[model samples]
Target chain A: MTVPALSVQGLTTHFFTRAGVVKAVDGVSFDLAQGEIMGLVGESGSGKTVTGFSLLGLVDPPGRIVEGSIKLNGTELTTLSGSALRARRGREISMIFQDPIATLNPLLTIGQQMQLAIAAHERLGKRAALARCTELLTQVGIPSAEARLRAYPHEFSGGMRQRVAIAIALLHRPAVLVADEPTTALDVSIQAQILLQMRELAAETGTAMIWISHDLAVVSSLATKLAVMYAGKIVEQGPTAALLRDPRHPYTAGLIASLPAMTTPGTPLTQIRGTTPSLLSLPPGCPFAPRCDKQTEACVQKPAMTLDGPRGWRCFHPVGQTAGAPT
Target chain B: MLGFIIQRFIQAVGVMAVMSVIVFFGVYAIGNPIDIVIPPDATQEIRLEAIRRLGLDRPLYEQYFTFLANLLQGDLGRSFVYNMPVLELIGGRLPATLELVLISVISATVLGVSLGIYAGYRPDSWVSKTIMAVSVLGFSVPSFWVGLILILFFAVHLGWLPAGGRGDTVMIWGVAWSFPTLNGLSHIALPAVNLALFKLAMMIRLARAGTREIMLTDTIKFARAAGLSEATILRRHLLKLISIPIITVFGLELGSTLAFAVVTETIFSWPGVGKLIIDSIAVLDRPVMVAYLILVAFLFVTINFVIDLVFALIDPRVRDGASA
Candidate 1:
């Protein structure tokens, strides 16, 4: 079989704070084929964004990738560091951030920022770079690419700034793009438009994506697969429709049940019983135990990942199963 | 933009108008200069003649209007001590202070920003810690004491440079500039450095704080994710983002240092406007005092205006607001 576009196995990243070590991303593993979009779903502090940052080697000090293998089309990324790793970043796998307002430099024009990004990896001539920049902008549905390039980030509306950010991220047309809630700060209508555009772009460019967001509904519309994280671990992952329809992890069940669409229109929405545990002091086995209604004594020891074809989960007593049923 | 400049200009004029009134009466309250101009032993005829010659025998309001009238006529009267036009006396001494302060402030900004960025970028490094320690010393040490120490070490102990004075000069644009000659440069070095220490510390603190904050921003992070080198990120993004505060402090320091490099000037025996102002105050030279104070007010207004224009140039957000 042809190699997957991106493969991550046993990824673990930790932040050494004075209080304690924060296991931001612990043993996250997944694979994305060309053109596939994987939605990494988690609440705040659940390690989804950290996973995205780790993929690009962008974690700052006091935080480090303690162990992992992140391979881009069969080329190992963890082995590279400094300039070598940076060279691979935008050219091989780039990322888009949550807030367009804060991500783009206020002092620089869109054209200059794009040029700077382009110059980072290649030595393109001015005319050629301009042509490429205009093409990318137009492709991202920005009208008047020529004049828009000279505009500052503030000149663009919130949605338009995100489009500019997307255009810049797509400059090198890398194999993978990790988007960290690129639409969370946008209006709902704008978010829908961007989601549709991003879906089309991924298909047209054949670029794999790891779309990180807490809004399961938003991700379900755009992503083919999903991974649910809790306390730095991926508790369950599978094809999006299958996992949403038949969530085997209690945490996933609570997330799906809490959605407004899933609840009776006038009734209170379902929510997990307890808050997420602090990463610094997670329980030895089953970080979700305190909040998992189906939690069993067997959960006192960590459950090995149970898999069926493309679907998998890490729970001793999963949803739809009696608490003491055979493993 | 034109409206903005015009508004600033009108504001500057109003400020000068107010300053002139304040300076006139303020000097009047500082005891009559006639006391110093005419000795106690002088005869009544000599004293009256001295008061008449100095325009002091006129009523207070009459004297003020006369001074104001002369001011509008491109004259500041004559300095009683120097026996020359007040404007000419100040103009002659301004070049020395201008060159000295310009060199020091500019050098301080450049060196401080570079060091500050390094310290902020690598805050955990020992070098950064050392830089921060030195900056603290810079803030605490008195400038006069520092000037004396600088002289004692670089001049007296090392004997590598002169102890005081503007050593030699080259005439440029009808003004004597000490920067051109080797001897003059050596003479200006200690005093410039002495003046720079406090400002350097301030700049370092400001820039360091700005850099530290900006480095954590998504702007810098986004730049890095796009594979921009660390140096390029620092230069293009971090520098521009941190520059507004640095520029503000730079302008303020430049004005303040120019107005009050008195201690360093005194220590170095540099014949700048600071020295000239001190001597005028010693003998209570009224014309020189009023003119000097007004000139200082004008300098501050002009510097602030220039800083506003510069802010617009560097930041597009400011430019948009300025136009509106």
Candidate 2:
């Protein structure tokens, strides 16, 4: 079989604070083929963003990747350092942030920031870089791209700034694009437009993308594969359509049940009881065990990530088992 | 932009106008200058002549109007002690003070900002801590005491520099500058450094805080993720982001430096306006004192105006506000 575009195995990132060690991403693993989109769904503090940061070696001090192997097309990234890693960052892998304004420098115009990103990895003259930037803006559905190049970050509205951020990320057609909730900050209509554009861009560029978001609906519409994380670990992983239709993990099933559309119109929405466990002091065995309705005596010990074909889950008693079905 | 500048100019004029009235009345409120001008044993006729000649006999309101009208006519009146035009006295000394302030401000900003960036970039490092410690000392120590200490080390003990006074100078555009000469530079160095220490410390703290804040911003992180080198990221993003605070501090500090150069000038006996003002205040020279106050007020308003313009130019958000 052809090598996957990006493969991560046993990735564990921990943050050492004065209070305690936070296992932000604990033994998470996944693979993405070329041009595929993997939705990483999780609540706040679930280590989804940390996982993205770790892939690019962007984790700051007090937070570090303890054990992990990140491979991009057969080349190991975790072992690289200094210029070696930096060389691959924008050219091979890039990221889109949650806030577009934060991603774009306020002092710099769109063309200047885009040119800097492009020139960081490639040698291009001014005029040529501008031409390429204008084209990228156009591809991102920004009209009057040439004129917009002179506009500063503050000049663009929230949605437009996000589009500019996306255009910048796609400038070099990186092999792997990690988008950390790129559309979550936009209005619903703007969100849909950006999501559609992102899907089209990923397909056209043939770039593997890990779309991290808490919104399952957006992820379901955009992601080909889905990985549901809870308390720093992935509870379930499978094809999006299949996983949404039948989530074997109790947490995944609870998330689907909590969606407003899943219940009858007048009935109160179902919510999973208890909040997500703190990463600094998780419960023994599975981090989600305290909140899992299907927990069993076996759950007192953490279950290994069990793989069945393309599907994987970490739980002693999954929801799909007939005996564990809820009345 | 033009309209904004014009509006600021009008505001500056209004400020100066109000300041002139306050300075005029404030100087009069201080014990009468005539007391110092004429001896107590002098006859009543001599006292009356002195009061009439000095325009002290006029009502406070009329004297203020006359002062304002004379100010418009480029007259700052005559100094009671020196028996010369206050404008000429100030003009002669203005260059020296400006020279000292210019050198001090430039040196302080460059040294402070560079050190601050280095320290702020790695705040936990031992070197940063050491720099911070030194900066704290710079801030806490009084300028006069620091001046004496500098004199003790560089002049009295090592004999490497002069302790006071303006040294040899060359004229540029009819103005004598103390640069490009060993003697002049060495003479100005001690006083300039003494004046700069407090401002330098303040600048370091401002720059450090600004740099720390900017480093954590999302754009900086994006720049890092874009594979830009640390130096490039600093120059392109961090420096620009921190520049607003630095410029603001520089402007305010420069104004205060000009306003409060008395201590440093006295310590070094530098023939700047600060020293002149101190001597005039001693003799109760009303014209000199009043002229000095107005000049300082004008300098402050002008500096703020310039800073506002520069601020708008640097930050697009401010520029947008200005146009809107």
Candidate 3:
């Protein structure tokens, strides 16, 4: 079998606070093929971003990857030293941030930042690096790419700044790209444009991407596969189209139902009923059992991920399984 | 950019004009200097002659106008204490003060910023904690006390350096300077460090705060995500981000150092304008006092102007905002 571009298994990241251990990403597992896009969907604090940070070994103190194996192209990244991990970061796995302006240094020109990124990974001459940077900017649909290189971050509009950020991420053409809500801060129209560009670029470069966002609509259109997270664990995972049409987990169902389009125009929009439980004092069994309508005595005990071919879910009484039957 | 600078220059001129008026009127409001200068046994004619010659017999407005006119003609009046032109007296003292302020500022900034970067980078480390503790002491201790302590330890106890005064004299381009000799350096060292302690502490705190704040910012995270090494991140992102605040503090501190060097100079018996100001104030030397205040104000405005220009040059946002 061909090795996946990125493979993560039993990934558990925890934060040791004064109160207790907060399991930000507990027993999460996923796989991505080259050129595939996986939408890591969650509410705020659902550990989507933490999972991304963990993959890059970017988690700071008080938080650590307690247990996990993140293998990229069959190379175990968790076992690598800091310098080795840094070497692989921009060269093999790069990230684009939510706020593009934050991703860029305001004092530096676009050219200077791009050159620094280039120089970090490669020893290209100044002329070659500028040429490469210009090409990447052009690829991202920036007009007057060469002239725009001299412009600082503030000179560009919000949308253009995001494009610059995306271009910088793509400069090295890393094997995997982690985009942490890269477009959520942008205008809707600009978001659509960036989404379209990213999809095309991913295909062209065969770069596997993990796009983390709270917006399901954008992810539904962009990603081929989807993983729904609830209270720090992947509650459901499957093909995006299949999962959206027939969601197995109640949380997934509620998320789908809560979409404004799912409800009749005159009626109120459906909501998930309760907020996500705090990571500090999550219930012993299932994290989402408190809010789930389908919860039973069996749910009080954590349900191990039950897989049926490629699709899987962590619920004892899933939607499609013997509806209303007592276990 | 040019327009912005010109506008700032005009604003500075207006500020200096307003300050001159305040200093002129405020000095005159104090007890008349003639009372201190002329003896009580002097005849009425002698007193009248002294008052007229000193421009004190004229109406306040007339004196102010005369002062402004003399200022326009590049004259700061004559010092009653020294019986010399106020400008000449200030000119004689300006170089020593400049040298002291310059040396102190450079030493403080380099040491403070370097130490601050280290502390901020590893805030949880013991070294950082120790530096922070020392900085707290640096901020709280009075400069005069610090100057005394420095003299006691380095000069008195160790007998390694001189206790006070600008040492040897050198003339270069017809301008007298404290020669860059060992004795000269030793004499200036104690006072300069004493003058620099508080500002050094402030710079360290500012730099530490600035660094810590910048480290948490998203741009720095992005730089890390982009695979830039820690050193690269520090150089490219952290340093640049912290620089604006450091520069601002440095500029303001430079002005304060010149203004407040009175304590340090007096402690070390260093001959600077600060010492001159203290002496003039005691003797009610109005011309010297007024000239010094106005000169310090001008220096402050000029420093701020330069800082703003630097801000514009370093940050394009400022540059764009200025042009806009």
**Which prediction has the highest TM-score against the true structure?**
1
- Stretches of model 2 off by over 4 angstroms after superposition: A322-327
Model 1 Cα lDDT, one tens digit per residue, A1-327: 889999999999999999999999999999999999999999999999999999999999899999989999898988986789899888889899999999999999999999999999999999999999999999988999988989999899999999999999999998999999999999999999999999999999998999999999999999999999988999999999999999999899999999999988999888888788999888988899878887677777877778889999988888976656444
Residue clash pairs of candidate 1 = none
Error of 3 at A181 (Å): 1.0
lDDT of 1 by residue, B97-186 (tens): 999999999999999999999899999999999999999999999999999888999999999999999999999999999999999999
lDDT for each of the candidates?
0.93, 0.90, 0.90
Q: Between prediction 2 and prediction 3, which has the larger DockQ?
A: 3
For candidate 2, what is the DockQ-based docking class? medium
Per-residue CA lDDT of candidate 2, range B146-215, in tens?
9999999999999999999999988887778787688899889999999888878888888899989989
Supply DockQ values for each candidate: 0.87, 0.77, 0.80
- Residue clash pairs of candidate 3: none
Relative to the true structure, candidate 2 reaches a TM of 0.98
TM-scores, chain A, per candidate: 0.98, 0.97, 0.98
- Measured with C-alpha atoms, the lDDT of residue B141 in candidate 1 is 97
Q: lDDT tens digits, residues A1-327, model 2?
A: 999999999999999999999999999999999999999999999989999999999999899999989999899998897789998887789898999868899988888899889888889988899899999999999999999999999989999999998888888888899999999888999999989988998889998999999989899999999999988888899999989998888889999999988999999999989998878788888788888777777777877777888998887777776633222
Query: Candidate 3: deviation at residue A119, Å?
Result: 1.2
Worst 10 residues of 1 chain A by lDDT: A318-327
Candidates' TM-scores?
Answer: 0.99, 0.98, 0.97
- Over the stretch B155-174, how does candidate 3's per-residue lDDT look in tens digits? 89999989989998677666
